[model samples]
Target: MRDFPSRRRGWWARQTPRRRVFFLALGTLTVLIAVGVGAGVGVQRRKDNGPAYLVDPTTPSGPPPDAYPPNPSPNGTVWQPQANSTWQIVLGSPITIASTATSTVPDVDMFDIDLFGNSASTIATLHKLNKKVICYFSAGSYEPKRPDSGDFKKSDMGKELAGWPGEYWLDVRSSNVRDIMLKRLQLAQRKGCDGVDPDNMDGYANDNGLSLTSDDSIAFMTYLSSAATSLSLAIGLKNSLDIIPEVVNMTHFAVNEQCVQYNECKTYTPYLDADKPIFHIEYPSNSPQLSAGDVSNSCNTRVDPVSYGAGGGTGTLSTLLKKMNLDGWVQYCDGKSSTTPTES
Candidate 1:
């Protein structure tokens, strides 16, 4: 989500010199107005949730060893998603799954939703309709609103994310953090999730304020992949492009965002080459009322002879045109749009 709040402007919007200067002046004015109003502009507030508690108390704590065993995959029986698999991701809220319904509104093969927001019953309902459930969570950031937010130690946090308030980059190397993430993984397994989509794994690529490196991300993926494989849950590599070659073999699929807009879709072709689905998302300007030019640009762009996988071939992406907030509304390359019913 471009490391920002859901409603914030896209990075591409500020690339022009005119917009950059305008935003700079606007930012200065906003800061000045905040100071005049005696408001805490950049401070992060932690929720009063009594005390830090583990999400999955039965799961063991502590970080895994530096070098762990290889993931039991490709040979092991895990749910491996194929290329060009149709899907929908709605993190803005939980989707409403009717028990008696024969299929979802979009009738996609997969549904990726917030891990904490969804219940096991919801996942089971999706399963009844023969849809795979991919639970979504942030593995490399501390979000204060999460149920297990208090579980994170103060020392385990770095600087706040630039545009996302109350969210801070996490020290992925910390045992406490890894322990918390392990519990999250266990929660996903317990919730009957077919797979887990762990976001913010690319903290090393941002101004994380923690001296995070690409090597640390690679190691973190290793740790997560081992735990997920053990739980018989498929895990996806989320936007850690720099370490794709290292971790692609371990991960079952790729959950990517803005690859097409950033002209980096080719970077994720490794997953396609491995016969893994690249569940891609693109947030076009003025979405929910997308222009024809915008739709054409998003769906018809070819990187290395690969399109959005309408034909389902090697180097193609299973792309979905979505709003930045990732609500139920979704548009496909075939010019079909549908809104999966979500809980209010």
Candidate 2:
């Protein structure tokens, strides 16, 4: 989701040696807290006769096979992103991924962009540059502007997404919808995408006319997981916190928006515990040039380690400061900003 726009302020970079040391120390402290709290919670749950929620760290590598369909077929190696991997997302414009000797986007590890708009050659170019491409698509909603919009059954369409004209939520329970999403996944595979970022997943939380519930989300995510895994394409849950406990094992990572502003970063650390990344974005509605306070509030938002930390406090995050439109412009925690070259 795009964030509300903040007014432009005097933006500046914070690359001082002292600030670097502070961030380094904060990272170490967060790790310690996470470890200590994790053990304590595990023990307490056992003592309190509560459900054992923590998965055994040594159980196996990758997501649980049970989350996928039976007898799934694999195509090739799935690109898994680390929690610390830096990224840039340009959904509003199809930016140039492959750089010439004269120009290039910032040297980030991954580039997330519109799936339907991007060309296979663009994805191939990113791969040639040793970069991972996460294709973005609307899995839970129907956009009338899409090329395949006519394929959606009339009965499967629900209420329009508020503020987004011509976009409506899809009934996740429909097999027809699933079939369309599978085609989208196939397209992503053909385009050579490393992973898929399916958006508008939290339709149940909205005033969706479909009477959809969290269970529907879980079922849909499961089906998507099975399809993605079978195609050897990694899939991420986009901003659906309620389904994390039920579907985190199936998800490769998370695409989160404004968790710090909403005071919900703690809920998403399950990805970190599962050794997956949370690609986070925050739109400072107050100013494009965020003040020091804005930076600290966004970057240092305390993540609780009760379910997920070592010293008993906030966890570090990989965050981006961007505008509401989600254009090519991006700013890191270090305060540097740049615009990726977008196609007109």
Candidate 3:
């Protein structure tokens, strides 16, 4: 996966010695907040054990269950993609389909594109081509340029995302932030998206100033899944493998980046164990120059068979080779390559 913007040290290293002293003082505040939120949840757990962190026991318990409706209608009918569905993602730019009447390239089942970058017409056009759409948006960070940027209160913002500019980690516990995300889901619902690719769900794993815990991330995702399901839009957990066991049931699928590079693909098999998809992407070292070995390594599934052999070995994953920018250029495991048309 592309390194997250704002390298935790890159930013600090760029600073002069005097400036480093200044930020270290600020980092102390972050430490205090992290300690106050309760420590020990940061340790990564083995796939067999699931996440070391569980939901905070002190959280208020809501009302008990009402029987699920036989045909519980969310805002619309939810469509869950298959575990092995082939897909393409183009988040860097808006795609210019060759023809509005029919798709001419990439015989993939689904297309994941940025929510705000493309319009409802783009989604409608994809529908005509029999392709499913997964709308992507930052669910755990505040992007300053989004139309709803103003919706985030100052208090809701936290440390700048490592390596990313104008983006800040959000306090997922904030009701206001949750409300804004609900509105984004509404937009997805209106645009006829089949599912949502919520990015930055792993803020707790970062040096976020808000002291967000795994419980907080779990709570946020739980709320997002329920909200998306209520809207008839499928929600996929994005890259927060640490809490997969806690939330596998809540999400319809998973979108992973650079799992092979980090050697953590095995940790995400819980999704496949439950018959959910893991849509994986790997940014090749050489853009457009992917070798056969790149394909083999990226597509390899290495998991402990003893722990997860419930008819589902390791996990089901669909790998896509993409440039770090994630434009239209793509290569499959077969080494076949194609570049979708993009507007100049």
lDDT of 2 by residue, 69-151 (tens): 43322446676788768899999978775434332477788999899999998887887777899999999999998889999
Where model 1 places Cα greater than 4 Å from the true spot, the runs are 1-76, 304-315
Provide the clashing-pair count of each candidate structure: 0, 18, 8
TM-score of each: 0.76, 0.74, 0.76
State the lDDT of candidate 3 residue by residue for 1-344, as single tens digits. 78755675577676799988888899999999898666544332223333333233432342223323223334457887887789999998988774445664588899999999888888888888899999999999999989999989999999999889999999999999998998899888888888999999999999999989999999999999998898788999999989998998888889999998899988876776776778999887886886788788877866544566465544467888899998899998888889877766
Clashing pairs in 1: none
Model 1 lDDT tens row, 153-172: 99999999989999999999
The candidate that wins on lDDT is 1
Please report, in order, the local distance difference test score of every candidate based on alpha carbons: 0.84, 0.82, 0.83
Off-target runs (Cα >4 Å) in candidate 2 are 1-75, 97-103, 304-315
- TM-score for candidate 3: 0.76
